[model samples]
Target: MESQPESHLLKLRKDTKENVRKIYNLDKPGRLEEAIKILQHWIQKQDHILKKDWNADYLDKTLIASKGSVEKAKKQIDRLCTMKTLIPKFFEVINVKKELPTILDLAMVMPLPTQTEEYYRVILVKIDTKEIKPEFFMMYFQYCLSVAEYIKTHDYANGFILVYDCRELNLAEVITKISTVELQQFITLLIEGYGARLKGIHIVSESKAIEMLINIVKQFLSEKVGNRIHVQRSIEDLPKVVPKGILPVEYGGNEKSIKELQEEWLEAITSEEHMEHLKVMYKACTDETRRNAGKFNEEYMGMPGSFRNLSVD
Candidate 1:
């Protein structure tokens, strides 16, 4: 039979090597450094391969071993056969130029995939590494881009939709009195401008937008910690996490500022009329139910209603 494919031969040869085997010897004596070095090499190889072949990826692959019999596994695989998601095949440690035996590091992960992909690449490193740090947001956007790109190229074949995921992100506390006008400037750019490559952005999460707003409201919130905020801003507030100096071309009257957006938001959120309209009902517990609750004696709870359990008391 013809020799195994060049890739298979490469794999087999490496599998036979002592250095390659060291990658898996995490607990072996004197192998920790080797394992780290190997993993780093693997990541470098992935980077190189991605930059080399347009259709090849270097992410590790996975095996699906179900608890069911072979038939079930086969059926499961068949079901997934139609899925559009890329399946990771397995991982390998490719050799890198002599770095260091003491270079073994762990915890940082290197991945390999079955096929090469066009993932979303954000240019936020420049901004993040500078100021108004978004914290792990670039990575989130990276993943979002990957999923969005995969769906776009695989499913739509060529179309656009307003794709944004704004589930949540931690709101960083900022100086209470400082004007976030600079940051708002950045938000305009983010919403209006595209990503690094100017390619169509199919997905953009709005979490950072929320984060910035939190920063803007820090001033108001400072007055009442733990109390609910009565937002006086309009619902269409501009983002507050924007970088120092950048604004989108699209603003009210084709001209606006962070202050204006904040004002609009204030109008929407703080209007006394709006507050009354926006009821925070507790499902309207019936008056009869309230009376019943009062009738429940201390025996049911096995405790006195006002025994003053505080340590001081």
Candidate 2:
């Protein structure tokens, strides 16, 4: 993989020896090994759908994120694999430079260089309706998956701090451009299928658009996720919850501006090396055989009515 600035990679607040033991059950003589064995057994049952070389590290992270529950880890892995194949529009073969350059500009998704004191990775999102094209929602979904893929290997442990700058977009544009169903799909994928720990979400918007967005989010997200939401009236108010030092200059922080960070990401994701890496990550371990097994739900294949039945499960 191409190297990023040291800051872009996840940095733990402290040594995680105790957390590793607790989350992965490494202290128990056989618990860690048993978890691996269980995942391996489950993989084999899928007819070699998961790559033969799927490493212990990947399964270990899944196990850790599932809070050491083998059953939950199994479900997480299955959901991820099935969704990748089931919804190829988002996961199949993403050529962002060609397919989504416009939507990427409209909804800028990138990680902050600094993490919280508790080691949570901070993700920044700013949606500008002025730049939005008609296909913004689907493209934004692709951008989100790109962000999730980047963090999956890097920031799986400490969870995430999601910061949304809602000032640029208003209620009218939001309600029309970003439908309730589309929002539900995005939230469902992040919370359930992605398997990342979500620490909290902060929405900074002076207008009442914050309430509108929050109400829509509350419809699909669980109380656990809903309660973690912190609404701020303005960008200045963010410092009280998220220290300014960890934010970019665009958000009144000391770091680089959000535009600069977005440009850096744009160049990186469009580059030849990063594009190849994304292709591998997208296609790897996708189980077409499992899909053909006739056990998956076809109704949950794509957006529209697909998300109506999905909760934080």
Best candidate (score: lDDT):
2
Question: What is candidate 2's lDDT per residue for 240-304, written digit by digit as tens?
Answer: 88878878886778988887888877765666765676677676555454444334445244433
Supply the TM-score for candidate 1: 0.17
* Model 2: how far residue 244 lies from native, Å: 2.8
Cα lDDT for residue 10, candidate 2: 46
Could you tell me which 10 consecutive residues in candidate 1 have the lowest summed lDDT?
Answer: 55-64
Q: How many backbone clashes does candidate 2 have?
A: 0
RMSD to the hidden true structure, all candidates: 25.2, 4.7
What's model 2's TM-score?
0.82
Best by TM-score: 2
